[model samples]
Target: MATPRSRGPELEHDVGRTPSLGYEPAGSYGSVRYLEHGFPNPLVRWHYHEEYELHLIVATRGKVFVGDYIGQFEPGHLVLTGPRLPHNWISTDVPEPGVALRDMVLQFGDAPLRQAAALIPELAEALPLLERARHGVEFFGLSEAARERFGRVRAAHGLQRLAEFATLLDLLVRCNDYRLLSTVQLQSFDDDAALAHISGIVDYLIEHYSESFSMAELAQRSGMTESSFSRNFRRATGNSYTDFVNHLRINKACQLLMETDRYITNVCYDVGFNNVANFNRRFLQIKGMTPKEFRRQAEARFGSAA
Candidate 1:
C-alpha cells in the first residue's frame, strides 16, 4: 500500500454509465464474489444501489461523499454504503484518463445479507454495523493487518467469501479508527425523487453561493412549487432552504478561515454572508468561536507544524 498523502486540489473522474437504482446483481452473494470492478465512471457522479457496498480505496486518494459531510479519504479507507444511498468517490486529484483510479468495491448479495442478519446469535452484534451503514459509515481505524486485508478485497471471491466478510465486519464493528458520517435520517431507495431533488439543490448552492438567490429559483431547479420543494428539501436533508444555505456559507467561511490567510470580512463576502455581524454570529454559532478565535486556534495548531 502507498503511504497516504495530504489533501489537495479539485477532484476529477470519468462520468460514465450509472447503475440503475433498482440494480441488484444476481448471485448467492454470501458465498459469492469477494471483489469486482467494471463500472465505467465508477468514481464519478452520485448513484444509488440496493446491494450493500463495501468500498476499499487503496492508493487512490479521494473524497467519499456519503451525505452532507465531505472530507479527506486515503488508502485503506473502508466505506460500507447501505443499499440505496446515493454516493460517489471523487478523486481529489485527476488520475490517468485511461488508467482508472483503483478501488475495491465489495457488493453484497442483499439476499444473503438480509437472511443472515435475521438469525439471532452473536452475529446480531453485526446488525449495528448494518444499521450504521444506512448513513454510509467510513472507517478511520486503518491498521496494518486490516489495511493489508483490504488490499486483497479486489482479488478475493467464492467459497472463502463468507469467512472474509465476517473478518471485514469484525474489523469494522471493533475499530475506533472511523467516524459515523453522522446520525442522519434513513430514507433508503424508497424515495428516489427526493434524493435526486436534494442533490440538485446542493449543486445550485455550490454554483451560486456568493450570489443572491430566491426560494423560487431553487424551486425552479427542482421543477416543484416553492412550498413543495422547501418541504421536501428540509425533509430530505434535515435542513431548511434558508438554514441550509446559511450552513453552507458558514462551512465555506470556516474552511477559508482555517485554510487561507484571508481577511475576516473578505472571507465573509466570499462565502455568501454579507453582513459582518451576521457572519460573526453564524460563525460563532456553528464553530463555537468567533472568526478571530477560530483563526487563532487554527494558527495555534498549524503554526508550529509549519
Candidate 2:
C-alpha cells in the first residue's frame, strides 16, 4: 500500500497529449522487445508510444496515472497499456540512493499480432485482452508468475522469445482477477483539440479536487458554451461533469481514509464534500463501501501508517 502526494509542476507538464517515445528495437527478437529500467531515468516520464506495453513494477510503490485513472501502485503492480495510451508512474517514497530496478517492460506492436492471428487461431485468443487494454488493464495475483515469464522472454530469442511472450499473454488472458483502469478510451477521441482541452481540465481537477468549482466556469475557461462543453466533456471522459468531479473527490477521500487518521466527517470536507451524508453516499456508490468500512479494510490489508 502506497500513499499519494500532490502533483508537482513536473507532473503538470506530464498531462495533456504527452510526448511520444519512439521505440524501434532492432534485433533477432523480431516483434517483441524486452526492456528493464531504473527510477529517476529519462525514460520514466509521462509519455506514450505506438506499441502495446506489458509493464511490471519490480520495485518501489507509487501513484500510477493511466489516461484518467489515478491509483496507487506497489511492487508487483502489473498493467498492460494499449497503443498511444498516456501513462506515468511517480514514486513518492524513494530512498536517497533511489531504486536501481523499478520496472520491467515488454513492448510489441498490434499489427504483427493481429496479422498473425488471422493465420493462427491460437494467437487469436489474445485479441480480446488487447482490445480490453485500450482502457488499460491491471492484473492481480500474477506478479510472481509474470516476473518469471518476463525473465524467460528476456532470455530467449527469435521464435523462442515470441513463444515465451505468447505464453505470458496466455496467462493474462485467462486471469479473472483483473480490472479495467481508465473509464475512457483515449484512442476513441477523434478531435485532437478537444482531447487536449479535456486532458488539461482533468489534470487540473486531479490536482485541485478539494477546491470548489462549477462546470460553467470550466466551460467559460475553455471558451466553449455550457452545452458544447457538456457534450465534449462527456465524450472525452465518459462521465458527466458532475460525475467526473465526484469521482475525483471520492478517489481522494479513499486515499485520505487509507493513509491518514482523520475523522470521517473531516475527511469528507477535506475532499470537497459539504455534507457527510453526501460523502458517504458517493463513497458507497463509487467504492462499494462506507468511509469507515473502507478505512478498516485498508488498515487490515496494508497496516495504516497513521
Alpha-carbon local distance difference test for all models? 0.63, 0.78
Global CA lDDT computed for model 2:
0.78
> What value does the lDDT take at residue 236 in candidate 1?
72
Q: Write model 1 residue lDDT over 264-296, tens digit each, in one string.
A: 888888888779999999877765678887666
Candidate 2 regions with alpha-carbon error over 4 angstroms: 1-25, 184-306
Task: Indicate the residue-level lDDT of 156 in model 1.
Answer: 56
RMSD of each: 12.6, 10.7
Q: Can you write out model 2's per-residue Cα lDDT over 245-300, one digit (the tens) per residue?
A: 98888877766764567777888898899988999999888877788877665543
* Number of clashing residue pairs, candidate 2: 0
